[model samples]
Target: MSLEIAISIVMTLVIAATPILLAGLGELVAEKSGVLNLGVEGMMLVGAVAGFITASLTGFTPAGYAVAALAGLCASLLFGVLALTIGANQVATGLALTIFGTGLSSLAGAGFVGTTITRLPALFPQGLAGHPIFRIVFGYDVIVYLSVALTLAAAWFLNHTRPGLILRCVGESDASAHAIGYPVTVIRYLAVAFGGALAGLAGAYYSLAVTPMWADRITAGRGWIALALVVFSSWRPWRLLLGAYIFGAVMTLELYSKAAGFALLPPEMLAMLPYLATVVALAVIAMRPSRGRLDAPRCLGKTFRAGA
Candidate 1:
Protein backbone atom coordinates (compact mmCIF):
# COMPACT_ATOMS: atom_id res chain seq x y z
CA MET A 1 0.00 0.00 0.00
CA SER A 2 1.06 3.59 -0.63
CA LEU A 3 2.12 5.76 2.31
CA GLU A 4 -1.08 7.78 1.88
CA ILE A 5 -3.16 4.63 2.00
CA ALA A 6 -1.29 3.46 5.08
CA ILE A 7 -1.93 6.77 6.80
CA SER A 8 -5.58 6.59 5.90
CA ILE A 9 -5.80 3.08 7.30
CA VAL A 10 -4.08 4.08 10.51
CA MET A 11 -6.40 7.06 10.98
CA THR A 12 -9.46 4.93 10.36
CA LEU A 13 -8.16 2.40 12.83
CA VAL A 14 -7.93 5.10 15.53
CA ILE A 15 -11.46 6.29 14.81
CA ALA A 16 -12.82 2.77 14.93
CA ALA A 17 -10.97 1.94 18.13
CA THR A 18 -11.94 4.99 20.19
CA PRO A 19 -15.49 3.97 21.05
CA ILE A 20 -14.54 0.44 21.94
CA LEU A 21 -11.76 1.69 24.15
CA LEU A 22 -14.12 4.07 25.90
CA ALA A 23 -16.74 1.41 26.56
CA GLY A 24 -14.17 -1.20 27.50
CA LEU A 25 -12.61 1.10 30.09
CA GLY A 26 -15.98 1.66 31.67
CA GLU A 27 -16.73 -2.05 31.77
CA LEU A 28 -13.27 -2.68 33.17
CA VAL A 29 -14.01 -0.30 36.02
CA ALA A 30 -17.29 -2.00 36.82
CA GLU A 31 -15.80 -5.47 36.69
CA LYS A 32 -12.94 -4.40 38.92
CA SER A 33 -15.56 -3.35 41.41
CA GLY A 34 -17.01 -6.86 41.23
CA VAL A 35 -20.00 -6.11 39.01
CA LEU A 36 -20.57 -7.83 35.70
CA ASN A 37 -22.66 -5.69 33.38
CA LEU A 38 -23.67 -7.31 30.14
CA GLY A 39 -26.07 -4.61 28.97
CA VAL A 40 -23.37 -2.44 27.35
CA GLU A 41 -24.82 -3.24 23.91
CA GLY A 42 -28.28 -2.08 24.97
CA MET A 43 -26.94 1.02 26.72
CA MET A 44 -24.92 1.94 23.64
CA LEU A 45 -27.98 1.67 21.39
CA VAL A 46 -29.99 3.84 23.72
CA GLY A 47 -27.19 6.42 23.76
CA ALA A 48 -26.98 6.41 19.97
CA VAL A 49 -30.64 7.19 19.49
CA ALA A 50 -30.76 9.62 22.35
CA GLY A 51 -27.69 11.51 21.11
CA PHE A 52 -28.94 11.64 17.54
CA ILE A 53 -32.36 12.89 18.57
CA THR A 54 -31.01 15.48 20.94
CA ALA A 55 -28.43 16.77 18.48
CA SER A 56 -30.87 16.83 15.58
CA LEU A 57 -33.38 18.77 17.64
CA THR A 58 -31.00 21.27 19.22
CA GLY A 59 -28.13 21.31 16.74
CA PHE A 60 -25.61 20.94 19.54
CA THR A 61 -23.29 17.94 19.61
CA PRO A 62 -22.10 18.51 23.18
CA ALA A 63 -25.64 18.58 24.50
CA GLY A 64 -26.41 15.44 22.58
CA TYR A 65 -23.42 13.71 24.17
CA ALA A 66 -24.60 14.74 27.61
CA VAL A 67 -28.04 13.32 26.94
CA ALA A 68 -26.55 10.17 25.54
CA ALA A 69 -24.40 9.69 28.61
CA LEU A 70 -27.40 10.29 30.81
CA ALA A 71 -29.45 7.83 28.81
CA GLY A 72 -26.74 5.20 29.21
CA LEU A 73 -26.32 5.95 32.90
CA CYS A 74 -30.04 5.48 33.42
CA ALA A 75 -30.07 2.24 31.48
CA SER A 76 -27.20 0.95 33.61
CA LEU A 77 -28.96 1.98 36.81
CA LEU A 78 -31.93 -0.05 35.68
CA PHE A 79 -29.64 -3.03 35.38
CA GLY A 80 -28.12 -2.26 38.76
CA VAL A 81 -31.53 -2.15 40.43
CA LEU A 82 -32.53 -5.46 38.95
CA ALA A 83 -29.27 -7.30 39.34
CA LEU A 84 -27.87 -5.75 42.47
CA THR A 85 -30.90 -4.64 44.46
CA ILE A 86 -33.45 -7.23 43.47
CA GLY A 87 -30.88 -9.98 43.08
CA ALA A 88 -31.68 -10.86 39.47
CA ASN A 89 -29.13 -12.77 37.45
CA GLN A 90 -26.54 -10.39 35.94
CA VAL A 91 -26.39 -12.25 32.64
CA ALA A 92 -30.18 -12.32 32.25
CA THR A 93 -30.56 -8.67 33.18
CA GLY A 94 -27.86 -7.68 30.74
CA LEU A 95 -29.58 -9.61 27.94
CA ALA A 96 -32.87 -7.92 28.78
CA LEU A 97 -31.15 -4.52 28.67
CA THR A 98 -29.81 -5.25 25.20
CA ILE A 99 -33.29 -6.23 24.01
CA PHE A 100 -34.80 -3.13 25.52
CA GLY A 101 -32.13 -0.94 23.94
CA THR A 102 -32.70 -2.44 20.49
CA GLY A 103 -36.47 -1.86 20.71
CA LEU A 104 -36.16 1.57 22.28
CA SER A 105 -33.60 2.90 19.80
CA SER A 106 -35.58 1.57 16.85
CA LEU A 107 -38.81 3.11 18.09
CA ALA A 108 -37.19 6.46 18.87
CA GLY A 109 -35.22 6.71 15.62
CA ALA A 110 -37.91 5.67 13.17
CA GLY A 111 -38.54 9.23 12.01
CA PHE A 112 -34.88 10.16 11.62
CA VAL A 113 -33.95 7.38 9.23
CA GLY A 114 -32.13 8.36 6.03
CA THR A 115 -31.23 11.80 7.33
CA THR A 116 -27.62 12.89 7.82
CA ILE A 117 -25.84 15.80 9.46
CA THR A 118 -22.51 17.59 9.23
CA ARG A 119 -19.75 15.84 11.09
CA LEU A 120 -18.49 17.30 14.30
CA PRO A 121 -15.89 19.91 13.47
CA ALA A 122 -12.28 19.39 14.38
CA LEU A 123 -10.85 21.25 17.38
CA PHE A 124 -7.64 22.53 15.82
CA PRO A 125 -7.38 25.36 13.30
CA GLN A 126 -7.60 24.57 9.62
CA GLY A 127 -3.93 25.19 8.72
CA LEU A 128 -2.53 22.02 10.26
CA ALA A 129 -5.84 20.21 10.60
CA GLY A 130 -6.50 20.52 6.87
CA HIS A 131 -3.20 18.87 5.90
CA PRO A 132 -3.96 15.48 4.40
CA ILE A 133 -1.03 13.80 6.08
CA PHE A 134 -0.83 15.80 9.30
CA ARG A 135 -4.58 15.62 9.92
CA ILE A 136 -4.17 12.03 11.03
CA VAL A 137 -2.57 13.23 14.23
CA PHE A 138 -4.60 16.41 14.75
CA GLY A 139 -7.88 15.86 12.92
CA TYR A 140 -10.09 13.89 15.29
CA ASP A 141 -12.76 15.45 17.52
CA VAL A 142 -12.72 15.60 21.35
CA ILE A 143 -14.08 12.11 21.93
CA VAL A 144 -11.03 10.51 20.39
CA TYR A 145 -8.76 12.45 22.72
CA LEU A 146 -11.04 11.68 25.64
CA SER A 147 -10.71 7.94 24.99
CA VAL A 148 -6.96 8.09 25.48
CA ALA A 149 -7.27 10.25 28.57
CA LEU A 150 -9.83 7.91 30.12
CA THR A 151 -7.61 4.93 29.50
CA LEU A 152 -4.71 6.60 31.27
CA ALA A 153 -6.94 7.80 34.09
CA ALA A 154 -8.38 4.33 34.60
CA ALA A 155 -4.90 2.86 34.86
CA TRP A 156 -3.82 5.54 37.31
CA PHE A 157 -6.94 5.27 39.44
CA LEU A 158 -6.83 1.49 39.55
CA ASN A 159 -3.21 1.30 40.58
CA HIS A 160 -2.27 4.56 42.28
CA THR A 161 -5.25 5.87 44.18
CA ARG A 162 -6.64 4.94 47.60
CA PRO A 163 -10.24 4.76 46.46
CA GLY A 164 -9.08 2.60 43.64
CA LEU A 165 -7.54 0.22 46.12
CA ILE A 166 -10.78 0.15 48.07
CA LEU A 167 -12.70 -0.57 44.90
CA ARG A 168 -10.38 -3.45 44.16
CA CYS A 169 -10.85 -4.67 47.71
CA VAL A 170 -14.57 -4.82 47.16
CA GLY A 171 -14.09 -6.78 43.98
CA GLU A 172 -11.59 -9.14 45.52
CA SER A 173 -13.79 -9.96 48.50
CA ASP A 174 -17.01 -8.09 48.98
CA ALA A 175 -17.83 -9.94 52.17
CA SER A 176 -14.53 -8.88 53.65
CA ALA A 177 -15.10 -5.37 52.36
CA HIS A 178 -18.50 -5.27 54.00
CA ALA A 179 -17.06 -6.60 57.20
CA ILE A 180 -14.53 -3.81 57.06
CA GLY A 181 -17.42 -1.29 56.92
CA TYR A 182 -17.34 -0.57 53.22
CA PRO A 183 -20.69 0.00 51.51
CA VAL A 184 -20.45 -2.71 48.86
CA THR A 185 -23.70 -1.97 47.04
CA VAL A 186 -23.09 1.75 46.86
CA ILE A 187 -19.59 1.35 45.45
CA ARG A 188 -20.89 -1.08 42.86
CA TYR A 189 -23.66 1.34 41.86
CA LEU A 190 -21.08 4.04 41.19
CA ALA A 191 -18.94 1.71 39.11
CA VAL A 192 -21.92 0.59 37.00
CA ALA A 193 -23.05 4.18 36.48
CA PHE A 194 -19.57 5.20 35.34
CA GLY A 195 -19.45 2.30 32.93
CA GLY A 196 -22.87 3.18 31.55
CA ALA A 197 -21.84 6.78 31.01
CA LEU A 198 -18.81 5.82 28.93
CA ALA A 199 -20.84 3.23 27.00
CA GLY A 200 -23.37 5.94 26.25
CA LEU A 201 -20.57 8.25 25.14
CA ALA A 202 -19.31 5.49 22.85
CA GLY A 203 -22.78 5.11 21.36
CA ALA A 204 -23.10 8.86 20.98
CA TYR A 205 -19.75 8.96 19.20
CA TYR A 206 -21.33 6.61 16.64
CA SER A 207 -24.07 9.10 15.79
CA LEU A 208 -22.32 12.41 16.41
CA ALA A 209 -18.75 11.58 15.53
CA VAL A 210 -18.56 8.39 13.45
CA THR A 211 -21.68 8.45 11.22
CA PRO A 212 -23.56 11.55 12.42
CA MET A 213 -26.96 10.04 11.72
CA TRP A 214 -29.65 7.90 13.24
CA ALA A 215 -30.29 4.24 12.37
CA ASP A 216 -31.71 1.15 13.98
CA ARG A 217 -29.15 -0.80 15.97
CA ILE A 218 -26.44 1.55 14.81
CA THR A 219 -23.87 0.22 17.25
CA ALA A 220 -23.83 -3.05 15.24
CA GLY A 221 -22.65 -5.32 18.08
CA ARG A 222 -19.65 -3.13 18.90
CA GLY A 223 -20.91 -3.13 22.46
CA TRP A 224 -20.63 -6.89 22.78
CA ILE A 225 -17.21 -6.66 21.24
CA ALA A 226 -16.33 -4.10 23.89
CA LEU A 227 -17.50 -6.54 26.57
CA ALA A 228 -15.31 -9.22 25.08
CA LEU A 229 -12.50 -6.68 24.88
CA VAL A 230 -12.60 -6.28 28.65
CA VAL A 231 -11.96 -10.01 29.02
CA PHE A 232 -9.42 -10.04 26.22
CA SER A 233 -7.44 -7.41 28.12
CA SER A 234 -7.42 -9.45 31.31
CA TRP A 235 -9.25 -6.50 32.88
CA ARG A 236 -6.32 -4.12 32.45
CA PRO A 237 -6.93 -0.61 31.04
CA TRP A 238 -3.73 -0.48 28.99
CA ARG A 239 -4.36 -3.87 27.45
CA LEU A 240 -7.91 -2.79 26.71
CA LEU A 241 -6.56 0.09 24.62
CA LEU A 242 -4.25 -2.24 22.70
CA GLY A 243 -7.03 -4.78 22.19
CA ALA A 244 -9.42 -2.08 20.92
CA TYR A 245 -6.92 -0.99 18.30
CA ILE A 246 -6.32 -4.59 17.21
CA PHE A 247 -10.05 -5.17 16.81
CA GLY A 248 -10.34 -1.81 15.14
CA ALA A 249 -7.75 -2.89 12.58
CA VAL A 250 -9.72 -6.03 11.87
CA MET A 251 -12.91 -4.02 11.36
CA THR A 252 -11.16 -1.54 9.08
CA LEU A 253 -9.74 -4.36 7.00
CA GLU A 254 -13.23 -5.68 6.41
CA LEU A 255 -14.33 -2.34 5.04
CA TYR A 256 -11.22 -1.98 2.89
CA SER A 257 -11.76 -5.46 1.46
CA LYS A 258 -15.30 -4.59 0.41
CA ALA A 259 -14.27 -1.29 -1.12
CA ALA A 260 -11.39 -2.87 -3.02
CA GLY A 261 -13.82 -5.36 -4.63
CA PHE A 262 -11.79 -8.32 -3.50
CA ALA A 263 -14.00 -11.15 -4.73
CA LEU A 264 -12.04 -14.10 -3.38
CA LEU A 265 -14.04 -14.31 -0.20
CA PRO A 266 -17.80 -13.90 -0.12
CA PRO A 267 -18.90 -10.48 1.20
CA GLU A 268 -20.95 -12.13 3.93
CA MET A 269 -18.01 -14.17 5.16
CA LEU A 270 -15.75 -11.15 5.04
CA ALA A 271 -18.19 -9.30 7.21
CA MET A 272 -18.05 -12.14 9.72
CA LEU A 273 -14.28 -11.95 10.19
CA PRO A 274 -14.34 -9.41 13.02
CA TYR A 275 -16.92 -11.31 15.02
CA LEU A 276 -15.18 -14.58 14.21
CA ALA A 277 -11.94 -13.14 15.45
CA THR A 278 -13.60 -12.17 18.71
CA VAL A 279 -15.03 -15.64 19.24
CA VAL A 280 -11.78 -17.40 18.43
CA ALA A 281 -9.83 -15.09 20.73
CA LEU A 282 -12.29 -15.67 23.52
CA ALA A 283 -12.20 -19.41 22.98
CA VAL A 284 -8.43 -19.48 23.01
CA ILE A 285 -8.36 -17.41 26.14
CA ALA A 286 -10.94 -19.63 27.83
CA MET A 287 -8.98 -22.78 27.11
CA ARG A 288 -5.96 -21.41 28.95
CA PRO A 289 -6.60 -22.71 32.47
CA SER A 290 -4.14 -20.38 34.14
CA ARG A 291 -5.38 -17.17 32.53
CA GLY A 292 -8.90 -17.58 31.21
CA ARG A 293 -11.44 -17.96 34.03
CA LEU A 294 -9.25 -16.84 36.89
CA ASP A 295 -8.15 -13.52 35.41
CA ALA A 296 -11.38 -11.82 36.33
CA PRO A 297 -12.36 -10.58 39.78
CA ARG A 298 -13.29 -13.36 42.16
CA CYS A 299 -16.68 -11.84 42.97
CA LEU A 300 -17.59 -11.24 39.35
CA GLY A 301 -21.17 -12.25 38.43
CA LYS A 302 -21.94 -13.13 42.04
CA THR A 303 -24.86 -11.41 43.72
CA PHE A 304 -23.65 -9.51 46.75
CA ARG A 305 -25.97 -9.57 49.76
CA ALA A 306 -25.11 -7.43 52.74
CA GLY A 307 -27.04 -9.51 55.21
CA ALA A 308 -25.74 -12.83 53.99
Candidate 2:
Protein backbone atom coordinates (compact mmCIF):
# COMPACT_ATOMS: atom_id res chain seq x y z
CA MET A 1 0.00 0.00 0.00
CA SER A 2 1.07 3.56 -0.67
CA LEU A 3 1.72 5.93 2.23
CA GLU A 4 -1.70 7.55 1.88
CA ILE A 5 -3.44 4.20 1.72
CA ALA A 6 -1.51 2.97 4.75
CA ILE A 7 -2.40 6.14 6.62
CA SER A 8 -6.06 5.74 5.75
CA ILE A 9 -6.05 2.15 6.95
CA VAL A 10 -4.31 3.10 10.17
CA MET A 11 -6.81 5.90 10.77
CA THR A 12 -9.74 3.59 10.18
CA LEU A 13 -8.20 0.98 12.45
CA VAL A 14 -7.79 3.50 15.28
CA ILE A 15 -11.36 4.69 14.93
CA ALA A 16 -12.62 1.12 14.96
CA ALA A 17 -10.62 0.39 18.11
CA THR A 18 -11.64 3.39 20.18
CA PRO A 19 -15.03 2.17 21.44
CA ILE A 20 -13.68 -1.21 22.43
CA LEU A 21 -10.74 0.40 24.17
CA LEU A 22 -13.07 2.68 26.11
CA ALA A 23 -15.42 -0.11 27.10
CA GLY A 24 -12.58 -2.47 27.92
CA LEU A 25 -10.96 0.11 30.16
CA GLY A 26 -14.17 0.59 32.08
CA GLU A 27 -14.67 -3.14 32.44
CA LEU A 28 -11.11 -3.54 33.56
CA VAL A 29 -11.72 -1.07 36.36
CA ALA A 30 -14.90 -2.83 37.39
CA GLU A 31 -13.26 -6.23 37.42
CA LYS A 32 -10.40 -4.83 39.43
CA SER A 33 -12.97 -4.06 42.10
CA GLY A 34 -14.24 -7.66 41.89
CA VAL A 35 -17.41 -7.12 39.90
CA LEU A 36 -18.20 -8.97 36.71
CA ASN A 37 -20.69 -7.13 34.53
CA LEU A 38 -21.77 -8.96 31.42
CA GLY A 39 -24.31 -6.36 30.34
CA VAL A 40 -21.73 -4.19 28.59
CA GLU A 41 -23.46 -4.74 25.26
CA GLY A 42 -26.75 -3.58 26.67
CA MET A 43 -25.23 -0.54 28.34
CA MET A 44 -23.62 0.42 25.05
CA LEU A 45 -26.91 0.18 23.15
CA VAL A 46 -28.69 2.33 25.68
CA GLY A 47 -25.93 4.91 25.45
CA ALA A 48 -25.97 4.85 21.65
CA VAL A 49 -29.71 5.49 21.43
CA ALA A 50 -29.68 8.03 24.24
CA GLY A 51 -26.78 9.92 22.67
CA PHE A 52 -28.33 9.85 19.23
CA ILE A 53 -31.67 11.08 20.52
CA THR A 54 -30.12 13.87 22.56
CA ALA A 55 -27.93 15.06 19.70
CA SER A 56 -30.75 14.80 17.20
CA LEU A 57 -33.11 16.93 19.25
CA THR A 58 -30.58 19.46 20.52
CA GLY A 59 -28.25 19.57 17.51
CA PHE A 60 -25.27 19.18 19.82
CA THR A 61 -23.00 16.14 19.65
CA PRO A 62 -21.44 16.46 23.10
CA ALA A 63 -24.80 16.49 24.83
CA GLY A 64 -25.51 13.13 23.26
CA TYR A 65 -22.35 11.67 24.78
CA ALA A 66 -23.19 13.10 28.20
CA VAL A 67 -26.71 11.71 28.13
CA ALA A 68 -25.38 8.43 26.86
CA ALA A 69 -23.00 8.14 29.80
CA LEU A 70 -25.80 8.97 32.20
CA ALA A 71 -28.05 6.41 30.58
CA GLY A 72 -25.37 3.78 30.94
CA LEU A 73 -24.77 4.82 34.53
CA CYS A 74 -28.42 4.28 35.32
CA ALA A 75 -28.44 0.87 33.69
CA SER A 76 -25.35 -0.14 35.62
CA LEU A 77 -26.80 1.11 38.90
CA LEU A 78 -29.74 -1.16 38.31
CA PHE A 79 -27.33 -4.05 37.94
CA GLY A 80 -25.47 -2.98 41.06
CA VAL A 81 -28.66 -2.94 43.08
CA LEU A 82 -29.69 -6.35 41.88
CA ALA A 83 -26.36 -8.08 42.04
CA LEU A 84 -24.81 -6.36 44.99
CA THR A 85 -27.69 -5.25 47.17
CA ILE A 86 -30.24 -7.97 46.54
CA GLY A 87 -27.63 -10.72 46.28
CA ALA A 88 -28.76 -11.91 42.87
CA ASN A 89 -26.45 -14.06 40.87
CA GLN A 90 -23.95 -11.74 39.22
CA VAL A 91 -23.87 -13.68 36.00
CA ALA A 92 -27.65 -13.86 35.72
CA THR A 93 -28.13 -10.21 36.60
CA GLY A 94 -25.66 -9.15 33.96
CA LEU A 95 -27.48 -11.18 31.32
CA ALA A 96 -30.78 -9.64 32.37
CA LEU A 97 -29.26 -6.18 32.11
CA THR A 98 -28.26 -6.94 28.55
CA ILE A 99 -31.76 -8.05 27.67
CA PHE A 100 -33.25 -5.01 29.37
CA GLY A 101 -30.89 -2.62 27.65
CA THR A 102 -31.40 -4.19 24.23
CA GLY A 103 -35.18 -3.96 24.48
CA LEU A 104 -35.17 -0.48 25.99
CA SER A 105 -32.80 0.92 23.39
CA SER A 106 -34.81 -0.59 20.55
CA LEU A 107 -38.03 0.80 21.95
CA ALA A 108 -36.56 4.20 22.65
CA GLY A 109 -34.78 4.49 19.31
CA ALA A 110 -37.62 3.27 17.09
CA GLY A 111 -38.74 6.73 16.06
CA PHE A 112 -35.18 7.81 15.32
CA VAL A 113 -34.51 5.03 12.90
CA GLY A 114 -33.07 6.18 9.58
CA THR A 115 -32.28 9.56 11.08
CA THR A 116 -28.85 11.08 10.56
CA ILE A 117 -26.85 13.61 12.53
CA THR A 118 -23.60 15.52 12.15
CA ARG A 119 -20.63 13.44 13.10
CA LEU A 120 -18.33 14.63 15.82
CA PRO A 121 -15.78 17.20 14.67
CA ALA A 122 -12.05 16.85 15.09
CA LEU A 123 -10.56 18.30 18.26
CA PHE A 124 -7.95 20.39 16.49
CA PRO A 125 -8.74 23.23 14.11
CA GLN A 126 -8.70 22.69 10.36
CA GLY A 127 -5.36 24.45 9.97
CA LEU A 128 -3.58 21.80 12.00
CA ALA A 129 -5.86 18.80 11.52
CA GLY A 130 -6.34 19.23 7.79
CA HIS A 131 -2.75 18.63 6.72
CA PRO A 132 -2.55 15.25 4.96
CA ILE A 133 0.39 13.77 6.86
CA PHE A 134 -0.08 15.69 10.08
CA ARG A 135 -3.76 14.83 10.01
CA ILE A 136 -2.72 11.27 10.68
CA VAL A 137 -1.76 12.38 14.16
CA PHE A 138 -4.23 15.25 14.63
CA GLY A 139 -7.40 14.46 12.69
CA TYR A 140 -9.23 12.32 15.25
CA ASP A 141 -12.26 13.37 17.28
CA VAL A 142 -12.01 14.06 21.01
CA ILE A 143 -12.98 10.55 22.11
CA VAL A 144 -10.21 8.91 20.12
CA TYR A 145 -7.62 10.88 22.04
CA LEU A 146 -9.58 10.42 25.24
CA SER A 147 -9.39 6.65 24.92
CA VAL A 148 -5.60 6.70 24.87
CA ALA A 149 -5.47 9.14 27.75
CA LEU A 150 -7.82 7.01 29.78
CA THR A 151 -5.60 3.98 29.16
CA LEU A 152 -2.56 5.74 30.56
CA ALA A 153 -4.60 7.20 33.40
CA ALA A 154 -6.07 3.84 34.28
CA ALA A 155 -2.70 2.14 34.33
CA TRP A 156 -1.27 4.88 36.52
CA PHE A 157 -4.23 4.95 38.89
CA LEU A 158 -4.24 1.21 39.40
CA ASN A 159 -0.55 1.00 40.10
CA HIS A 160 0.46 4.32 41.65
CA THR A 161 -2.44 5.50 43.76
CA ARG A 162 -3.35 4.50 47.31
CA PRO A 163 -7.02 4.11 46.45
CA GLY A 164 -5.90 1.85 43.67
CA LEU A 165 -4.22 -0.36 46.22
CA ILE A 166 -7.44 -0.52 48.22
CA LEU A 167 -9.47 -1.39 45.16
CA ARG A 168 -7.14 -4.24 44.35
CA CYS A 169 -7.36 -5.47 47.94
CA VAL A 170 -11.13 -5.51 47.68
CA GLY A 171 -10.97 -7.48 44.47
CA GLU A 172 -8.59 -10.00 45.91
CA SER A 173 -10.22 -10.28 49.29
CA ASP A 174 -13.43 -8.40 49.82
CA ALA A 175 -13.93 -10.11 53.14
CA SER A 176 -10.53 -9.02 54.35
CA ALA A 177 -11.10 -5.50 53.09
CA HIS A 178 -14.46 -5.44 54.80
CA ALA A 179 -12.86 -6.65 57.99
CA ILE A 180 -10.53 -3.71 57.79
CA GLY A 181 -13.57 -1.38 57.73
CA TYR A 182 -13.62 -0.76 54.00
CA PRO A 183 -17.07 -0.35 52.47
CA VAL A 184 -16.75 -3.09 49.91
CA THR A 185 -20.22 -2.76 48.47
CA VAL A 186 -19.93 0.97 48.01
CA ILE A 187 -16.60 0.66 46.26
CA ARG A 188 -18.06 -1.95 43.95
CA TYR A 189 -21.06 0.25 43.14
CA LEU A 190 -18.74 3.04 42.05
CA ALA A 191 -16.72 0.68 39.90
CA VAL A 192 -19.82 -0.68 38.18
CA ALA A 193 -21.09 2.83 37.54
CA PHE A 194 -17.79 3.84 36.03
CA GLY A 195 -17.90 0.83 33.73
CA GLY A 196 -21.42 1.63 32.63
CA ALA A 197 -20.63 5.27 31.86
CA LEU A 198 -17.67 4.37 29.67
CA ALA A 199 -19.67 1.64 27.96
CA GLY A 200 -22.31 4.27 27.22
CA LEU A 201 -19.78 6.70 25.84
CA ALA A 202 -18.39 3.93 23.71
CA GLY A 203 -21.89 3.32 22.41
CA ALA A 204 -22.27 6.98 21.61
CA TYR A 205 -19.10 6.76 19.57
CA TYR A 206 -20.94 4.34 17.31
CA SER A 207 -23.93 6.61 16.74
CA LEU A 208 -22.12 9.93 16.72
CA ALA A 209 -18.86 9.08 14.99
CA VAL A 210 -18.78 5.67 13.34
CA THR A 211 -22.00 5.92 11.35
CA PRO A 212 -23.53 9.27 12.32
CA MET A 213 -26.93 7.59 12.25
CA TRP A 214 -29.21 5.51 14.41
CA ALA A 215 -30.17 1.92 13.73
CA ASP A 216 -31.19 -1.09 15.75
CA ARG A 217 -28.15 -2.58 17.51
CA ILE A 218 -25.71 -0.11 16.00
CA THR A 219 -22.91 -1.54 18.13
CA ALA A 220 -23.08 -4.93 16.35
CA GLY A 221 -21.87 -6.92 19.41
CA ARG A 222 -18.79 -4.81 19.95
CA GLY A 223 -19.71 -4.74 23.62
CA TRP A 224 -19.22 -8.49 23.97
CA ILE A 225 -15.97 -8.14 22.13
CA ALA A 226 -14.96 -5.53 24.68
CA LEU A 227 -15.79 -7.92 27.49
CA ALA A 228 -13.65 -10.55 25.83
CA LEU A 229 -10.96 -7.95 25.39
CA VAL A 230 -10.78 -7.46 29.14
CA VAL A 231 -9.98 -11.14 29.52
CA PHE A 232 -7.69 -11.17 26.51
CA SER A 233 -5.65 -8.43 28.16
CA SER A 234 -5.30 -10.38 31.40
CA TRP A 235 -7.04 -7.43 33.03
CA ARG A 236 -4.19 -5.04 32.32
CA PRO A 237 -5.07 -1.58 30.98
CA TRP A 238 -2.17 -1.30 28.53
CA ARG A 239 -2.82 -4.81 27.31
CA LEU A 240 -6.46 -3.88 26.85
CA LEU A 241 -5.44 -1.00 24.59
CA LEU A 242 -3.20 -3.24 22.54
CA GLY A 243 -5.90 -5.91 22.31
CA ALA A 244 -8.50 -3.39 21.19
CA TYR A 245 -6.25 -2.23 18.35
CA ILE A 246 -5.57 -5.79 17.32
CA PHE A 247 -9.26 -6.48 17.20
CA GLY A 248 -9.75 -3.20 15.42
CA ALA A 249 -7.32 -4.35 12.78
CA VAL A 250 -9.32 -7.55 12.40
CA MET A 251 -12.60 -5.65 12.11
CA THR A 252 -11.14 -3.21 9.61
CA LEU A 253 -10.32 -6.07 7.30
CA GLU A 254 -13.98 -6.64 6.49
CA LEU A 255 -14.37 -3.08 5.31
CA TYR A 256 -11.16 -3.13 3.32
CA SER A 257 -11.97 -6.49 1.78
CA LYS A 258 -15.39 -5.33 0.72
CA ALA A 259 -14.00 -2.13 -0.75
CA ALA A 260 -11.37 -4.05 -2.69
CA GLY A 261 -14.00 -6.49 -3.99
CA PHE A 262 -12.10 -9.53 -2.82
CA ALA A 263 -14.40 -12.22 -4.21
CA LEU A 264 -12.50 -15.12 -2.75
CA LEU A 265 -14.40 -14.84 0.51
CA PRO A 266 -18.13 -14.36 0.65
CA PRO A 267 -19.33 -11.07 2.12
CA GLU A 268 -21.04 -13.02 4.87
CA MET A 269 -17.80 -14.82 5.67
CA LEU A 270 -15.90 -11.58 5.62
CA ALA A 271 -18.36 -10.15 8.09
CA MET A 272 -17.73 -13.08 10.41
CA LEU A 273 -13.99 -12.62 10.46
CA PRO A 274 -13.78 -10.34 13.51
CA TYR A 275 -16.01 -12.48 15.70
CA LEU A 276 -14.29 -15.58 14.43
CA ALA A 277 -11.00 -14.12 15.47
CA THR A 278 -12.41 -13.31 18.89
CA VAL A 279 -13.47 -16.90 19.48
CA VAL A 280 -10.22 -18.32 18.15
CA ALA A 281 -8.10 -15.98 20.24
CA LEU A 282 -10.09 -16.79 23.34
CA ALA A 283 -9.79 -20.51 22.72
CA VAL A 284 -6.07 -20.24 22.36
CA ILE A 285 -5.82 -18.27 25.57
CA ALA A 286 -7.87 -20.84 27.41
CA MET A 287 -5.78 -23.73 26.14
CA ARG A 288 -2.57 -22.23 27.42
CA PRO A 289 -1.19 -22.62 30.95
CA SER A 290 -2.94 -20.85 33.82
CA ARG A 291 -0.75 -17.75 33.82
CA GLY A 292 -3.28 -15.51 32.11
CA ARG A 293 -6.14 -16.82 34.22
CA LEU A 294 -4.02 -16.26 37.28
CA ASP A 295 -3.98 -12.60 36.45
CA ALA A 296 -7.73 -12.41 36.98
CA PRO A 297 -8.96 -10.72 40.15
CA ARG A 298 -9.51 -13.51 42.66
CA CYS A 299 -12.98 -12.48 43.81
CA LEU A 300 -14.37 -11.76 40.36
CA GLY A 301 -18.15 -12.36 40.01
CA LYS A 302 -18.62 -13.29 43.67
CA THR A 303 -21.61 -11.75 45.42
CA PHE A 304 -20.54 -9.76 48.45
CA ARG A 305 -22.51 -9.04 51.61
CA ALA A 306 -21.35 -7.10 54.64
CA GLY A 307 -21.96 -9.87 57.20
CA ALA A 308 -22.09 -12.95 55.03
Highest lDDT model number: 2
Query: Candidate 2: lDDT of 282?
Result: 70
Over 4 Å off, model 1: 261-269, 275-293
CA-lDDT, candidates in order:
0.89, 0.91
Tens-digit lDDT track for model 2 on 177-230? 999999999999999999999999999999999999999999989898899889
- Local error of candidate 2 at residue 127 (angstroms): 2.3
TM-score of 1: 0.93
Q: Which residue pairs in candidate 1 collide? A: none
lDDT of 1 by residue, 144-192 (tens): 9889999999999999999999999999999999999999999999999
Please name the candidate that would achieve the greatest TM-score relative to the true structure. 2
TM-score of each: 0.93, 0.93
